[model samples]
Target chain A: MIELQHVTKVYPSSPRPALDDVSMQIDKGEFVFLIGSSGSGKSTFLRLLLKEDSPTKGVIKVNDKTLNTMSKWQVPKLRRTMGCVFQDFRLLTNKTVAENVAFALEVINKPQRTIKRVVPEVLEMVGLDGKENRLPGELSGGEQQRVAIARAFVNRPLVLLADEPTGNLDPETSQDIMLLLERINRTGTTVVMATHDYHIVDSMRRRVIELNDGILSRDQSRGVYGLGR
Target chain B: MRVNFVLSEVAAGLRRNLTMTVAMILTTGISLGLMGTGLLIANMIGDMREIYYDKIQVSIYLADGITDPQRDAIAAQLDSSPEVKDYLYESKADAYARFTQQFQEQPALIANTPQDALPESFRVELVNPQRYPVIAEQFPNGQNGVDEVRDEGDFLDRLFSLLNGARNATIAVAVVQALAALLLISNTIQLAAFNRRNETNIMRLVGASRWYTQLPFILEAALAGLIGALLAIGGLVLTKILFVDKTLAGPIKAGIIPPVDWSAIAAISPVIAAAGVGLAAVAAYVTLRLYVRL
Candidate 1:
């Protein structure tokens, strides 16, 4: 669950604010999408949600913890409960698919037994079962994305924040990935996906929040991502 | 939390940056080896000084045809001299007897010689042979038929000065090389860190602890240093045993130059081994401190 109250951010060199007093809330077990154009505040909103950058003005809460006021020391602990996927898969090229997923557990100092057990199941669930031994280079773009998904899910984090999860995949592959994300959401983990993909946004008819030039322009339940001039 | 996991990561990291690891090893090895040389030379100088000061006895050859009154005056002067530990006056007859005994192979020559042909001498021992100048100066241009005073310790002083110079030069050279190696290894590790920046980021993102990310790099550098140090230690032993002991030790033992302090060289090997591993770890930690982020 996430809540941003009057959150605003401004970069020193830019006149236009990246997020203009954006206030929104996302509930547990909810599937949501933040849709906008190229310069939309979608990514900025996600960054704030992940606590990667502090907001200039206001409070943002995730899992009942107010991130805006949390000290630097507490940020990593906050992130432990959330899974994040980037536009670029961000896989370590040197690590195999299993290692990439195992990386998540490793950071948490998970036991080898847990890693050996969970890594394969997560890989299998994301359709990368036998390919665990293969490196990222050996996998296709879609499979690489699947590996990323498995890594995100392996920790069984409370929330999943994705910034363009399927931007590089074909539409059909995108649907398959979205279906996987939807299945994960059904398992009671919150999902906040930020994207410029109109079709998937329109097709899902999930709770939608649209941002335009750093302003939250729409909030609708079971909504399509259409709110143009 | 797991030491083995940290070690495995370290092993993998070392494997990843093989060239940098090797460079760190060589840098540490060369620095420590030079340092060991300075230490060994300094110790050897100390040993030489010890032996020379302890064993060098002064010889005072008495003048021929000296009367008992002259001997009495010499004995009076010797008794008051601060340099003398103990001195015994050997008569001409006693000198001839000693010569005959020492040169037993030529007993006939000694049996035919008259006592007057041998000179009366004072066999003098000093309080400290290093204070040889004290007694040697006493009999200079002999006032009481004291022919000459001799102490062999002056030669050791010259040798000590030479070794001291060598030790100082080795220390200076080692310091310069140590700094240069530090800079070079720092750059190498920096480049290696840059190459793995993404991996570091991912680790940070995944909630890996600071040491979790750094332990591997440090261990890799340490392992490389360990290898280099072992090589240096082996080389040092080989130099001492094969070259120093076998060739130089024999010639020098017969007093051509000076005997090698082999125990000192042997003592240096373990320190070099420890230094090798220490330098590698330090380099790793230092480079990481300057360039890496948790």
Candidate 2:
């Protein structure tokens, strides 16, 4: 579950607020699409949820824990409950696919047995079971993104955030990635995806929250991307 | 398992930035070596000061043509003087014997010296060695069979000051080199952090604590520092063996300078090592805090 109460974020270098007077609550296990144009506070919303940056004026609560007053030391614990997938599929290039997924567990100080058991399972779930030893650079764009997803999901975080997960993938590969995300959402992990892909959004018909010029424009149950533009 | 992972990360970081690591290690090693040299010189100066200060004396040499009465009067005057704690009358034969024994390593100098060529003098030790002027005034030269009144304390002062200057110069240079070494370490850590920003970002994203992301960089600098310290110790050992023990053997054997024994080097090695490791690790930690997010 995620909740934002009148969250307004204004970066010092920029004149306008990135997110202005935004109020929203996402229930547990919901698949939500955050629809917005560029610079419409989509990434800022995700960053706020991740606690990477704090809102200039607002409160954000993820999984019943208020993030506004969260101490610096507790940010890592907060991140442990959430998974983040980026457009670039930021895998360690020098590491193998298995090591990349295992790295998430390793950083969290998981036991060797757990890492060994969970890494391959997650890689297999992301459809890279046989490519454990391959480097990220050697993989295709879709395969690399799968590796990223495997890494994010390896810890079994409660919430998964995908920021333009299919931004670099072709249409067919993008649909496959969406199917994979939908599969993940079905396992009771709340998924919040931020994107500009209208075809994927219209076809999926999930809950859509649209942002326009840093303001909440529409919140529709099972909405399409271009409805309010 | 976590320990192995962290250690592997440290190893990979060091390997990835091999040239920077090598540069940092060499800088640290050279600086720590100079520091060790400075410490050794300080220890040697301390030993030499103790040896020379304990036996410092003023010598009033007699005129060659002086009578027995003149020599006896000079000796009696030295004995009765309040400034003189003790005095020894070294006859011509005694002076010649001491000179020959001191230069025994150079037999040519002793072979050319005649027994009567050395001066007969009274070597006077004062209670307060700084009161050399008082003794000198009491035994004015050219008056009471005293040809020259020389205060060994004066020569010792000049000599110790020269050695102190050398020690100070070496330490100053060492301090400068240490600053350069610290800067190099800071820059190297920053560069290493920059190069691995993507990995660290992912690590942070996946619930890796900031310390977990940073430990590898700190450990990399510390490992380089540790190796640098070992190299410095080796340099010091080599210098002692090659330069101090071998090249300066004559001075040490002749008692002109005290020998730099193994214990002195062994005593200061831990300090050098701690300095190398502590400075580098601290530099890296501080650089991470100030410049790099991780």
Candidate 3:
């Protein structure tokens, strides 16, 4: 679960707050789409959730732990319970697909035996089974995204935060990634995705929270991306 | 954390930054080599001081044409003095014979020296060598049977001072080289971190702690330092064998200067290794804290 109450983020030397007086709640195992245009506080929202940036004046509770009050040494522990995916697919270019997925578990100090076993299973789940030895540079964009997804899911984190996971993919590949994400959400891991993909947002009927000019404009159950301010 | 995994990462990092790694190692080796040389010089100075200072003697030269009774009176005065630990009276003939024996290798010099040229004196060893002034005052110049009182300890003082200056100079240069080595280590670590920025970014994103991300880089520096220390020790051994032992063979054989032995090198090897590893690791750690985020 994630909760943000009266959250406002202001960047120094900027005239306005990035996220102004924002409040939201998402329960366990819900797939929430955060729809916003560029510079509409979507990235700032995700960064606040990840504790990468502190809220200027707000309280953020993730999994019942108040993030604003947490010490720096506890940040890594908080992050270990969550997974993150990026727009660029953020795979290590030099590592093989399997190694890339295993890297997630390795960082969490997983045993070698568990990494050896789970890496293949996650690769299989993401449909990257046969490309285990291929580097990210050698893989297609869609396949690379799958590797990134596999890496994110390898630890079975309680929450998954994706920032434009399919931003660089074609429409067809983007649909496939959405389906994969939907399947992952069904397995009881809460998923929060920030995106500007109108077509994908319109097709995937889910709980949508729309942001416009640093304000929450709409929160709808079973929503679609509407063309409205 | 698995040490094997960390070690593998360290190996990969070093391999990627091979040129920088080599540069760091050579700089560290040279620096530690100079440091070890300085330490060995200090030890050599200590040995030389013990060798020379223990044998220091003061000579009370009798004036020419002195009577036997005056000489006997001076000898009686020396016998009663507590400052004289022991005295050997060398007559002119005995002094000349000893001089000839010393210059036996130079036949021309030995042949030109006459029998009465050398002085007859009391070669007096003091109970405490530093009490030369007491002996000088007891047998003053222009006194009965006294010409001059010469203390070998004064010349030893000047000699040791020169050796101390050389030792201090070597240590000073070593300190400068050590500073250069530290800077090189810092730069090399920064470069290595920059090269592996992508990997480190992913590691940080994947729940790796800051220390976990830094471990491999630190290990790489430490390994380079370890290799550098070994090389420095080897350099010291080679110098002892090829330079000191060979060049100073005659003096060492004659016991004029102490030979730099294996025990002295053994004593300093650990200190050099510790300095190498400690300095390199500290430099890398500080660079990471200040420059690289991780």
Best by DockQ: 2
- Count of steric clashes across candidates, in order: 1, 0, 0
Ranking by DockQ: 2, 3, 1
Under CAPRI classification, how is model 1 graded?
acceptable
Candidate 3, RMSD to the unseen true structure: 3.0
Better of 2 and 3 by lDDT: 2
Ranking by lDDT: 2, 3, 1
Tens digit of lDDT per residue, candidate 2, span A1-229? 8999999999999999999999999999999999888999999999999999999997899989999999999999999999999889998998999998888888889988998898988888989999999999999999999999998898999999999999999999999999999999999999999999999999999999999989999999999998554
Winning candidate number (TM-score): 2
Model 3, chain A: how large is the TM-score?
Answer: 0.98
- lDDT against the true structure, each candidate: 0.79, 0.91, 0.89
lDDT of candidate 3 at residue B42, scale 0 to 100 = 92
Model 1 residue B47 lDDT? 65
Cα lDDT for residue B291, candidate 2: 95
* Shift of residue B201 alpha carbon in model 2, Å: 1.4
The collision pairs in model 1 are B10-B216
lDDT tens per residue, model 3, A129-194:
888999999988999999999998899988999999999999999999999999999999999999
